[model samples]
Target: MAKIMALDYGLKRVGIAATDDLQIIASAIGTQPTAHIWEFLKTYLAQNQIEAVVLGDPKNLDGSATDATAPTEAFANEFRKRYPEIELHRMNEVFTSRIARQTMVSGGMKKKQRQQKGMVDQISATIILQDFLSRRSNGLF
Candidate 1:
């Protein structure tokens, strides 16, 4: 089976993560500047056989879309337009940042590492991918 990629999009930087070829373990791919996202993704897609792309979708606590949602959805749309053959999925991104922080803490990350916002993005992408994998494993449409 082809691997999957997950993205945690920000205005300036984007966090990326990918699943193993077996689709069992998720790993942080790194963060990239918005200006280089397309090139980075093109190179990554060319190197790895990715079947789908998952993006973090921000929403309000009450399930309403947030202001960031607009740009995120736009990004997803543009990504679809650019990579028409790839499947794109948006996963609800609630508490992902918090979870990322907690994960860093639990992982005994250094202060400097924890202070880096890019690390949070990578962790967020991992969480997004994990959620997507779980949902797919359960056959949730």
Candidate 2:
């Protein structure tokens, strides 16, 4: 079975996560600098069977576009055009960063370790994928 991948795209980096082939577990993979995301994906996709991609969609409290919204959407569009064979999905990402931080704290990560931006990004991607998996399993997606 193919896996489902999730990405949390930030201006500086893109966090990556993926499900097991059984689509039952989501794990944080790593991160890539924004400039190297395409290169990273090219290699990753070639090495893995990814059935779909879940993209973090940023939105304001009122559902207005956040500064990152357009960029995320643009990236999603480009990804769709570049890899038309794979399915793509967008998920509301409000408070994911905050949640990621809290997760680090709860996981007993040291302050300095939790402060690392890349760690939060990877956790955020994991959260995105886990949420997607939950909703899909519940037939809400």
lDDT of each: 0.92, 0.95
Error of 2 at 5 (Å): 0.4
Q: Give the per-residue lDDT digits (tens) of candidate 1, residues 26-64.
A: 889999998899999989899999889999999988999
Model 1, which residues run further than 4 Å from truth? none
Q: What TM-score do all the candidates reach, one by one?
A: 0.96, 0.98
lDDT for model 2, please.
Answer: 0.95
Model 2: per-residue lDDT, tens digit, 1-141?
Answer: 999999999999999999999999999999999999999999999999999999999999899999999999999999999999999999998999999999899989999998788998998999999999999999988
Clashing pairs in 1: none
lDDT: which candidate is best?
A: 2
